[model samples]
Target chain A: MGFAIDKIRADFPILLRQVHNKPLIYFDNAATSQKPQQVIDALVHYYTYQNANIHRGVHALSQEATDAYERARDLVKTFFNARLREEIIFTAGTTHSINLVAHGFRSWLQPKDEIIVGQAEHHSNIVPWQMACALTGAVLKVLPIDENGQLQLETLKSLLGPQTKLVVVNHVSNALGTINPIETIIEMAHGHGVQVLVDGAQASSHISVDVQALDVDYYITSAHKMCGPTGVGMLYGKKELLEALPPYQGGGEMIKEVYFEGTTYAGLPHKFEAGTPNIAGGIGFGAAIEYLNTIGLEEIAAYEHELLMHATQGLKQIEGLKIYGDITHKTAVVSFNIGQLHPYDVGTLLDRMGIAVRTGQHCTQPVMDFYGIPGTVRASFAFYNTKEEIDIMIKGVQRAVNMLQ
Target chain B: MIIEAQQEIIEEFALFDDWMDKYEHLIGLGKTLPLIDPQFKTDQYIIKGCQSKVWLRAEQQDGRVYFWADSDAIITKGIVSVLIRAFSGLSAQDIVNAPTDFIKEIGLNDHLSPTRANGLVSMIKQMKLYATAFAAQNNA
Candidate 1:
């Protein structure tokens, strides 16, 4: 089925606003997407009716909260096609999710145990692993990407040795919108007896995911990336692997028993969740998943793919615009630098025209270092984004170049 | 149509005119930052979400409030200069009553990335909280 832009745009309220006397053209989807009415309404419904601490009380309000929270978990499991809801853990978004894995999985690590990550990985994915390796006497091995921002598999194969314990890769590059060949990555990692974790923060919104079919041991996603609440996210693990790992933080609801001498931890997902959770966020996330499911992932992906093509063609026509991450089989993220213009300056100028595109490194500094540039102005798209918006973005970029040049 | 925060901030550019020269003098003033000892950059004093290495030291001289900020980066030093000019030597009520209009006044917010602005807000809030504590201590 093809994408239906008109129908999709109708669902997002913010797409209709104006900026600087011009219609608002929101192209910064990779940073965070606009929440649909269903998700917003879900948050409102949650706070208005089911507002209580979850998983710890027998009161009616607690029961409602707990049920809603678990239902969100079930929705996530279904969204990712995981085998069990217990395998999914709630988190404060992708950054926190990755940090929890780093902290919790530290016990299993050893000196010189190689942890492979990609050069294009976000700071969240890179820094935590760097800290984990630094703390645990492990070595961080990087799989380099070529000029186009796609990983060189032959180089990656050379880097993957017997000592490689874990391979963490982004399923989609947020800066470049490069849809990585994760299936191949998982297969290769498994061949070397290495566990793999995929940062699906970008991919969860654009692609359909099936954890069972991919055979990935761990996958992390942020709900805000997929039109859900800002503070809520999920970490999917194989049940056996999660059950064996240690708890990330010590607090209420994450433990089954506590005492001065000894304490026992809660099962699987709960072990990672410490203190009071974002109860409203979880329900909102579930609503976001339901909303996406209704539209169909295939429909969204196909429409966005077309938008990417249109955007690429439009962006290509602009002079002095050097596009980053030109992958043929990528999603809808287009990052580019206008010659002689600082990204911050360009972003400011674009704001004057009501064009919202992300500037700076997009939080991928290593990638910026590789390119030997400060940063790029990134215009990422969603299913609701129209070709007309890209035209506006292109005109804005041209104006920026002319004004600054 | 939304007026870019940049326009609002830029409108009050005169407040920070020659801010660079003033910033240099501020750093020179920072050299006179009171002695609390040299070993205060421990993990306890570290503030999260800063791009530059910053160390904040708070002290009181009789009735007035004084702050000492040292950063490894030049722009960060400039930022500290702006903060010092805005809040230093004020009475506790003055410190508490001072509006964040200074950011817009100097166009500092216009030049800053959103994250950097947030970090700046955190720093200002922390300084204000410190002032509040000093006020409480004196009252007691």
Candidate 2:
């Protein structure tokens, strides 16, 4: 069956918004996806009726809230096909999730131990490991990408050794939209007895993530990128690995017993969830997952792949436009530059035309350094986005190019 | 004259009916800006908090401050151009005391994205800091 594009578009209210007296064609989905009305309603319902603290209170409202919150965790666990419900840890966002893992590994790591990270990783994935290495006296190494923007797998294999403790890489590149071969990478890392963390911040929204099938040590993603509320995300780790790692934060929910002496930490998920959580966000994330499931991730992926092909063709028609990243394995993201024109100029001009595209280093300065450019004008798409929108974007880019050049 | 320069910018922007035309004008202005020397592109002269790398160089000659600036991004360079035109070749005290409300009056602030607006503020702050430094040197 074909994907219902129009029906899905209607689900997001922001699609109806107009920018600069023109219809809003949001192509900045890589930064954050527009929340569907279902997710929005979930948030409102929580604040309106189910607004109460969870896990601690014995009242009816608290029980109701706790039930709803726990249900959201179950939804997330199922969405990622995690082994155990306790393995899913609610976090502030992708950065927070990665930092939590990195923090836990600080004590586990030893001097001269090595960590491998991809050059295409977002700063969030790279910086935390650098800090972890600095603190633990571990060495940090990088897996470089080829000219086609694919990770140098042979180089990665060469880097892995007895000293290699962990391999960190993103499932998709936010800057270049390169869909990494993480399954292969994970399998290879496991052979070397090295733990692998996949930053699924960009992938979880567009692709199905089965942590069990992938057998990755840790998988992390932000809810905002998946049409959920901001300020919330999830981290899925192997049950044993999570249990072995030290607690990331010391606080009320993350504790089992407290005294002047050293306190016992809470088990599994709660050991990392420190304070009052984003109750509404968690519920909204569950609603987002429900929404995605209704449409289906596989179908969304197919439709978006079609959209990406259309955009690539449309954008290629423009003279002097050069696109970064390999098209064969990519999401619905097109990062490009025209002639000698700066991306900010193109992005600013496009904004005037009511097309919202991202223009910057995209939090991946190393990728930018690799490309030897300041940044590119990025037009990323969600499933709700249309070929018609891509047409408008192409026309807008053409107009901007003419004006700037 | 600085106020008059700002007034001229406002009048120029008013001639354009749409943002596209206004941005074209800004880009044109950017192309004609007195660019800073490559030596001054060092981190010491760069303004932090700008999404684009902005380099500003100031020279005080005969009790007046002359400013030259550049940015990697065209729009940011345009913004730097507007700032330089308003404050350059003015006395240190005059440049420091110049009103920034002219930027809003020209509708530039409304046209700018939040990050660009922050960059505008950073550029203005750096210019004033340069003016202040030059003023202190004169006093010494």
Candidate 3:
């Protein structure tokens, strides 16, 4: 598969724009990827043509909308390479997806049941399990990481026991960009009869995930993290696991039948999907999946790796710049600080130069706390990014360091 | 008098054409900000929203209030200094009534914009809050 750089860049309209009198260098892909024209057109196409509530009415528009929504589900199902179409459930985003599963586990988790969360997991991932633990009498455990932000697999092995009910970890660390050892974690957890939930929010766009291949019990990711619309995401669970877990929300379409005396719930996908739903967003998500399919994820991954290498090499040239995270195992994310200068100061200078990067803890305060720093400036790249842009950012970082020093 | 102070700060910032020059000037001003009393530099006086640690405290002498602020981030330190120059040494009523149009006039969006990266708005609000409390207590 040939990775067409210029052709890919042309697909995104925002890439053509300028910021602060300089060309826009968006290094915030982990926060959110830039939308391609195809994705935008999908959103526009949905709102323009098929605008109706899904899963119900017999009207022509309703059928069209329902088809588009289900088609998105089909795309999500295939994109993740799940066995059954019903295994994929739509929710608001990765956060929402996790909360739903965590809520379901409240009933399943016993007083002594232990849950292990990766130390590098963001507050969003941590807080939900905390709520579940608080409500149930279950205990929450931490999986420690080393200086390079790599999870201490030995610690995970030690943490795994019969009492461990579920192990939650991200496919990629949003803060350090470490591609966590989820496969090993899953296999280890399964050995002790523990299920695994992988947060694929940061990994979904840059790479493709095969849920079946990973043998992951539960996988959650947001559409917006990929080129899909925000407020739309998918949750994949094994047939038996999802069947055992109850529906997250109760409302229209999720019900098989409702009565004053008793109510029966709908099966599989619809059981979790209730209320009006983001019909337009679902359609747009399918469009995004289709768009990604054309470019090919393998090509995107290979091209992105080159960008990562170029960025890492260039960033290492800056004197006094200390980079955090595992260079060999991470995705295309560079989290670093210049000398003793605060990351916020570094980020502000970069922003002024039209190089948009994320500063602060990147919503994973534990990672920062572990490193004993306020925060690190993060520069995340995507396939659309180029070597020239990385060179500019390297010079930009050098200039920023000079000014701050 | 507060308005005059704001205009002076605004005039000083107007000399810079681009953000780089403006940021350089802010960095210089940051180095010159008077130290917050060492005693008040604890976490109690620190503002909550900023990414960097910002400690702000105020005291009233006779009828006028003097503000003291500090931040680990230099741009933020400069921002608080600029704000202090505008609102310090004013009576409680004068400090409370001071118009803050000069914030936009000077354009410290790096700190002042909705990013709330550094809380200049919170610092100003905190200063007024001190003035309001002092006014209620001493009836200035």
As for TM-score, the candidate ahead, 1 or 3, is: 3
The ten-residue window of minimal lDDT in model 3 chain A covers A321-330
The 10-residue segment of model 1 chain A with minimum total lDDT is: A340-349
Q: Is candidate 1 or 2 superior in lDDT? A: 2
Clashes of each: 0, 0, 0
Taking chain B only, the TM-score of every model is 0.69, 0.92, 0.92
Question: How much does each candidate deviate from the true structure in C-alpha RMSD?
Answer: 8.9, 1.4, 1.3
iRMS values for every prediction: 8.7, 1.4, 0.9
In the range A1-405, model 3's lDDT, one tens digit per residue, is 467888889999998888888889999999998889998998888888988877778999999999988998999999999999999998998999999999998999889889999999988899999999999989999999899999999988888988999999999999988998788888999999889999999999877889999999999999888888888998999989988898889999889999989889988988888888888888888988998899888888888888898988889888988889946777899999887888888888888898999989999999999999999999999888999999998998898887777
Q: Which parts of model 1 have CA positions greater than 4 angstroms off?
A: B1-140
Q: Can you give the TM-score per candidate against the true fold?
A: 0.78, 0.97, 0.98
Query: Please, what is the whole-model Cα lDDT of each candidate in the order they appear?
Result: 0.82, 0.91, 0.88
CA displacement after TM-score superposition, residue A385 of candidate 3 (Å)? 0.8
RMSD of 1: 8.9
Error of 3 at A356 (Å): 0.6
**Of the candidates shown, which would achieve the greatest DockQ relative to the real structure?**
3
**CAPRI band for model 2:** medium
Candidate 3 residue spans exceeding 4 A from truth: B109-111
Q: Which digits, one per residue and each the tens of the lDDT, describe model 1 over residues A1-405?
A: 456668778889998888756889998999999999999999998899989998878999999989998999999999999999889999999999999889877888999999999989999999999898989999999999999999989987888888899999999999999989999999998999899999999999899999999999999999999999999999999999999878888999888999999999988788889899999999999999999999899888888888899988888888878898887688899888767556755676677688888877788999989998867889999888888888888887887666555
